[model samples]
Target: MSGATGTGTTMREAFVATAGHLLDEDPRVAVVLAAISADVFADAARRHPDRVIDVGIREQLLVGVAGGMALTGMRPIAHTYAPFLVERPFEQVKLDLGHQGVGAVLVSVGASYDWAAGGRTHHAPGDVALLDTLPGWTVHVPGHPDEVVDLLRRAARTDDRVYLRLTNDGNARAHPVGAGFQVLRTGRRAVVVAVGPVLDRVLAATARLDVTVLYASTVRPFDAVGLRAAVLAADRADVVLVEPYLAGTSTHAVAEALADVPHRVRALGVRRDVELRGYGEPADHDAAHGLDVAGIAARIHAFTRA
Candidate 1:
């Protein structure tokens, strides 16, 4: 099992370790599952049977139970694949937790096309966009296992509704987890905002270019102030957002942030126009969606030249 330190651990391992630690250290912490990562929690469940709940294949009930637990003053951590956790049980998430105004941490894996072999049934490129319709949610897309551990711990301690989107992909290095964007590189031409695991590819794509690169794990609460600051620091109010989920997911946020400043933005991410049916690997999906280093660089170069 991985520890809270998070070094050399997968994002899933970090989540399990952090959640287990929360259960051990906090009495209010409870874990609700829909059969995802159940075996990992066997020991924790044995120790705190009352708090660890597995609701079998019922995705709706999985969220309902967590909401019910939250109603009773318990903080619940709900787990499952992205499509099942966010898209399948959305109504439950909307009413049980959102409408009722209770808090629960929902952790999801198999981001976007991580399990490409599972096909469209397993993909969730619109999870963040769906969540955007709701109010008062803290959405985290961690690029590293360390960030996952950090964000999960932060979410558990609070009563806010949190979505910790973990993934099979990760960055080479972990940036400091903070409320706003962490500025990695600065330039005056344009601002390139890389969300989550796409940071590495974005850095590589823009290595020889003159652009400011900002890394964001926390996309919600959209960090308008930070984005504005970065944009204003640049010579041109041009922004390029590269997200891990649906393309243009955060474009509206960027527009709103740069409103009244006469800025331009180009958003890049998983395509929403057509469903990509074939996939050999995660990189294959990335290339198909123009999220690979070359794809990203080409788009950014064009935007900068324009």
Candidate 2:
């Protein structure tokens, strides 16, 4: 619903829509989010106390508790800041949730430069690599708020463990739902796919380079078949998977999937170490390291020449 600023609906509204519809269908839909968006889930929780579990500032406890609730047959949707959700409780996440193979969904906000002034400490760019490595985990990186709702629906229907990488621009952006990448446009030279905030830049660069734009919302459980299809569709053109995380996009994941396709594959994400300058918003820091849209567009074009 949050369709990019003045385009459609707000992200908070989309979150509400997704949660509200799911709750209506299942009275057992217990919510376990944080105070970050308390008002968003409060109304639903107020109406159904037995369905909401608030664990403020305790990300590890929140996730562990949610896993326990799921084991006890209570459907819990735990929410928290992306950094806290994964970093604060890395062990709890790896052992309590991943190792045990918990079936609850982790709806994380502040994903990938969503935090402006919080600096590198607050930014969450490691989620993809961390979550993907955990056994039996499914990761979804929705391009917009609309896709957030769609992915949630798909998660609800599936039986595997899930995590939605979230980014709130303080505005709403729209995203589509599915298991993997979706090409928004076609090109003859190369295939350009975006993972996070750079989708906007990719759309703009469509005219600059003889390239096709693809949106990759589902990070893990990557559709190798889908990647192969994009390569084949592009006449075996070069394929690039883009991301803002520090090399989180799985080049190997795509490479293994499209091994037979004759094309060079490169993953575009933040480098492992840029020795960032003290502090600033996540976007500024990312921009300094060529993680912004302009940098992303340039990289895709370079691949075309190579």
Candidate 3:
């Protein structure tokens, strides 16, 4: 597959633009911005003032209001940074949306350390883990701007509770959408699963290794079936899961999926312990967390040999 690098559009721009289109096309579509990317939707807000609203930095009200709109039969799309969207308004997400059984499309940017210079307050390594606590949430971690557009459209069309995670990092190419993992390359010694924006780095990491690589954009409904099939195809019970968030986020699901088979698993992702007080760019944070290409390659090489 060809990797599309240096694309003019970014995931954030794609999401905001597509969301605006949804707002114009569908009357039921309502957007609640937390002043995070309010400017991105300024035109939409002006055109449909009642449908698109900026709650001005209040994360709690941002979610609560969306839930309220959903209750009134409007499909709400709430946008903000990951920390503000999921962490700050967690209770509102749990009670207003989850407990109340109302569905809203929650879109968040600045995944993990995407805004490394913004410090821990802006970092949200636990966003997905927090959402996992609630049941029936369709979580999507798109790796490209095109994928973001597609997933946002999909989420907007349904009333199901959805959380679309957006990040500054991305892969070279966009793959087809499905619940199962898409096999990008084949090998025999082991299988490596790359989640969302980690695909390009994972590919570079395992380039020389004799291992199968699978890419996944949607991880919440972990593709156990596809995972097992890929593992079996590689004829290697050894599996390595590379995620962008906290390590071992999908370890449980992988274990359950391969329960019947004899296998060894390794999980790689951002570290939960220790605070890296220094940050320059996303690459800087990735290197510190051993998520850079060299770091990932070193770990995967050692794991495959083991």
Give the least accurate 10-residue stretch of model 2, judged by summed lDDT.
1-10
Q: What are the lDDT scores of the predictions, listed in order?
A: 0.92, 0.71, 0.89
Winner by TM-score between candidate 2 and candidate 1: 1
Candidate 3 per-residue C-alpha lDDT over 193-303 given as tens digits, one digit per residue, 9 for 90 to 100: 999998988999888889999999999799999998888888679999899998888888889998999999888998878678897888888888899999999999999
Q: Please list all clashing residue pairs in model 2, or write none if there are none.
A: 2-9, 2-172, 2-173, 4-172, 4-173, 116-281, 147-175
Q: Which ten residues in a row have the lowest lDDT in candidate 3?
A: 1-10
- Tens-digit per-residue lDDT, 1-306, candidate 2: 123546565455676678877877876577786566777777787777777777787788888987887777666677777888887888888877667766788888777656656776677777778776677878877666777777888787655678877765422355656776777787778777687456775676556777777777776777787767777877545877677576745877877887766668767776776656456766676677666667776777777887
Error of 1 at 43 (Å): 1.1
Global lDDT of model 3: 0.89
- The order by descending TM-score is 1, 3, 2
Q: Is candidate 1 or candidate 2 better by lDDT?
A: 1
Number of clashing residue pairs, candidate 1: 0
Cα-based RMSD of the predictions, in order?
A: 2.2, 2.7, 1.9
TM-score for each of the candidates = 0.97, 0.88, 0.96
- Clashing residue pairs in all predictions, respectively, total 0, 7, 1
Misplaced by over 4 Å in model 3 are 1-7
The numbered model that scores best in lDDT is 1
